[model samples]
Target: GKDKPTYNPKKERGDVVVVLNAAHVHLTHDKWNTKLYRWHTGYPGGLRSRTAREQWEADPTELIRNAVNGMLPKNKSREARLEKLKIFPESEHPFEGFPLVPFLPKPRLLQDRGLGWALPQHLALVRWCPPSLLLTPRGPGLGAAAQGFEPANPERYRFRLRTSPGLQGGAGRPVVGIEDLLTEEERRALAAAGQQGV
Candidate 1:
């Protein structure tokens, strides 16, 4: 745990102190091989990594700390928490001399990047909002709901009414639904693509 700093909980307004046990951390699939842990000693390429397993052997606690951290919101508290964390290969930590308490990992659902934008109707909603694509009736409907309109499932909302009340009578045009959801997945795939931009 010497890899991290120790702090006092009694000093509520100051920095924090976290003691970690590296031996029992978990990591997703082959991230150990592909994940790169790079750093710099104010010199050239000081990048580093221990192939998950290697890191486990070197400092088991850091591996877990890093895995959990990557899932957190990138912000001030994120940085602070990392600063206070102290990883140890064994249960016996140097932080024992400080206000040491067991650190519990938060149980967070790993939302697929494709599904990150929930509220399926968000796109429809956005298009319907003050500005953007939904500005038009998305093939019909003028801020007015059709017969069985359910806001919860944008798929239930149909927009086949005529643009002009007396026009060709709302014809069937695509109103984005499950099929449209696929594009989100496609976006994620592209996002995960490599070196060259797709």
Candidate 2:
């Protein structure tokens, strides 16, 4: 973990060290083959193109440096800024002199966690329940118990209510249950309150 120097033209030039582990860098499917690096030799018909895989095979350090340079803002200072970028093919580097403080990887997507990734065991999976499903009459003496409302079950909360025979609603309107969708705990609570669920 190297410190990135602040860009200030007036102040003395500083160093920004960027260390990359080429072995661990993950690229999306087919990008290794499809992504191409092109450059010209400052002459007619001197264009050349090579896939990322080929470039990495040829020189991994240059490949990493080029990738990082491409992400930097294009300006007169771009070259100066790129000069500060130091890439290493592997984790080995001469950064032991500084107090290395490893940074936590900021995962932007599910795939960013790498293959077969998952949340920590201590973290609980939260299931969001719609307010309507948990709503109860708020009038005096009419709490959740009186309204026969309970926490929705993760398994059955999203399913459509079953239709009963000989019970039909308007042609366009659909008939749905109000309390029958409750889990066993909810039904037990309703039974305790002497209220029949739908």
Clash pairs, candidate 2, are: none
After superposing candidate 2 on the true structure, give the runs of residues whose Cα lies further than 4 Å from its correct spot. Answer: 1-15, 107-198
* lDDT (tens digit, per residue) of candidate 1 on 66-180: 7668975676656666766555654465555776443322222223246434333312322222111122223322343233333444543233222222122222311222122
Clashes per candidate, residues 3 or more apart or on different chains: 6, 0
lDDT of 2 by residue, 42-83 (tens): 899999999876776787677677887889767776787777
Per-residue lDDT of 7 in model 1? 46
